[model samples]
Target: MNDNNARRVVSVIVVNEASVLSRITDLFSGRGYNITSLTVAPIPESKYSRLTIVTSGSVRVIEQITKQLHKLIPVLRVYEHEDMVEKEMALIKFPISENLSDINTICEAYNGKIVNVGENVVIAMVSDEPKRIDNFLCAVKRYNPKEIVRSGAVALER
Candidate 1:
């Protein structure tokens, strides 16, 4: 990353169609732009889907990408988010023998909790700001996590 490179969150609203996602992703890949995180979800009671994309680029690079996104046929709107509420979720599995109380406390601090307990594993889910989630992942390393699954970033302009 360069000094000019900064993380950006872009939200694209598009008509729901089978090929829309493929085309959008193709646009990024074809242009050599990297998408660090992408979250797509259908808008409730609407014929559209919202795609939240997280990427790092210089200001001019992000502007170029946004301009190209608007040219796609199915795209309804595209904008870079500012003053947004963004979040990410992570699920970490630890051995059953790990300290459940400690894990639960950590999860609670991150707006999550142990959601599942199996005979041999315990799954803790934490949803929080992306940076905080990164911190949580680091904080839990001492417990010897068996597996970890993290979701892409999602955001909404506040």
Candidate 2:
């Protein structure tokens, strides 16, 4: 595989501390790794945080990243998601005048629903597989979405 096109999602469990995020990001930047998506949040009732990072590189480069991450003082565990169930959440806002019924139908198709409705705007939220979310975005283009926000990928080993 080409070095630039290989996509991998890596999950890192690290101590929840102020400088941990900066240290981890510095590691990537120093090594010239490009992170496509990054999400960090503390695990409930625990002193650790989960960092979900999406990046691309060749197999060798990924292995190097894994090894380096393991060497970090705050990092506890790292997992490269393989055969896991991953999901992403997205929210889209569009003009309310543009057929609310049609928007609801499209949202339903993606296992989403209208999350908010105002006089001028309608907001829909969806949590689905990455590919499905991508398709949903493509399908809703005709609505002229005012804004779209997608959350980082979250995974559970199945």
Candidate 3:
């Protein structure tokens, strides 16, 4: 990819209603824009949801996407974050035979803790910035994770 094609984050606020996500995603697909990560959740005590999308494109393409997003009927607002706080969560599972003390130490480094321990597995939960989360995943490779699930990025503009 060209250096001009940089990763960008866009946050969209929309009405909390059926088919809203479908319509929003269709706009990207119809235009052949690829979404690297997407996170959506309803705002508490309100009929609105925030969609956080991560994609790669040139500045021009991002401008176009922002313009198109504003055209959607249910969309309440759309903005590309210039200064924001971003985070992602990851859940990693390891074999029960792994050393608990070592695992806990590693988890603590990433703001993680043992959320569950079972007869056959140990599950850990970690939340941090996307890059830090990536580093955490890399560091935990020595433990041989049995499974891992990571949530998409969620961001708030400053």
Candidate 4:
């Protein structure tokens, strides 16, 4: 990409209705834009859903995406995160043979804890800034994680 193309985070608030996600995604796919990460969740007790999308594009392209999003009937608001707090969550499963104490220490250091202790594995969960989560994942590789699941970036403007 050129210097103008940079990673960006955007949030779309829309009415909680069926097929809304497909329409929004279709706008991206139809335009040939790539969504690097996407997270959708309902606003608590509200009839709205928040769609957080991460993508890479120039300012002009991003502006076009925002304008298109605004045109969608269900979409109420579209925001490009400039000043926001962003986070992500990850769940990691490690072999039971790993040192539980050492693992617990590492998890605690990263604001995580052993959430489950199965017969053959231990599960740990952490929610933090995306970069920190990436660091945590790298640091835990030594423990031989059996499986790992990660959530996409979520953000709220500050």
Candidate 5:
């Protein structure tokens, strides 16, 4: 990707109602934009929901998105992450027969720890920077992770 076309995280607050998500997604698809990661959740006890979208585009394209999003009736606010605190969560399940001590040690190093241990599997939960989670996943291959899932980035301006 071009240096000028760096990835960006945008937080959009919109009315929690039908067709809002589809309309936002349509706007991106219609413009040939790509969303790398998208997460939507209701703002607790509120009439709005928050959407965190990760995408890459030129400065002009991003500006266009901001302007267009503002025109949407349901959209309340849009924020571009600039000097923001971002976090992502990941869960990995490892074979129970694997070395539990080693997995626990690795998890501890990354601000993670055992969340549950079933008869045949161990589940670990970790929350950290995106890169740290990626590194943890790489280190976890030795333990034979049966499955892994990662949440999309959720950021707040610090």
Candidate 6:
């Protein structure tokens, strides 16, 4: 994609209520915009939830999205993240035959550790920048992972 289509992160704070997520997603779908990743969770001690959305578009398109978000009744705030700290979590399961020590060391490097050891598998959890998590997945390929699940990016402005 061109620079105009560079990836963007948009954070939306909205009232916690049914259909809120559906409404937000519908807005993107209605506009033919694809959301690369989305993470949502209730804000502590409040009736609001924060939605972190990752997508790509021209500056104009992003601005349009922000404006549309503000028009949503439940949406209380919307902003495109500029300088932020973001992280994603991934869980990978490998056969027990893999070297445990090596897996432990690799996980440690990614701010993670082996979270569980099953009778036949070893499960590791890693939380790190999205790019670094991609690298970690590549680094562990030799172990023959059985399953992998990754979370959407969660971010906070710095």
Tens digits of lDDT, candidate 6, 1-158: 34788999999999999999999999999999989999999999999999999999998899999999999999999978889999999999999999989999999999999999999998999999999999999999999999999999999999
Best by lDDT: 6
Candidate 5 per-residue lDDT, tens place, 38-106, comes to 989999999999999988888888888988988899999999777888888899999999999889989
Candidate 5 Cα RMSD (Å) = 1.6
For model 6 the local lDDT of residue 55 reads 92
Model 3, span 62-117: residue lDDT tens:
98999999999999999798789999999999998988788888888888898999
Better of 3 and 4 by TM-score: 3
Ten contiguous residues with the weakest lDDT in model 2: 1-10
Task: Report how far residue 31 has shifted in candidate 4, in Å.
Answer: 0.6
Give all TM-scores, in the order shown.
Answer: 0.97, 0.94, 0.95, 0.94, 0.94, 0.97
**What's the CA error at residue 43 for candidate 6, in Å?**
0.3
Count clashes in each candidate, considering only residues at least 3 apart in sequence or on different chains. 0, 0, 0, 0, 0, 0
Q: Is candidate 1 or candidate 4 better by lDDT?
A: 1
Clashing residue pairs in candidate 2 are none
Runs of candidate 5 exceeding 4 Å displacement: none
- Overall local distance difference test of candidate 6: 0.95
- What does candidate 5 score on TM? 0.94
lDDT of each: 0.93, 0.90, 0.92, 0.92, 0.91, 0.95
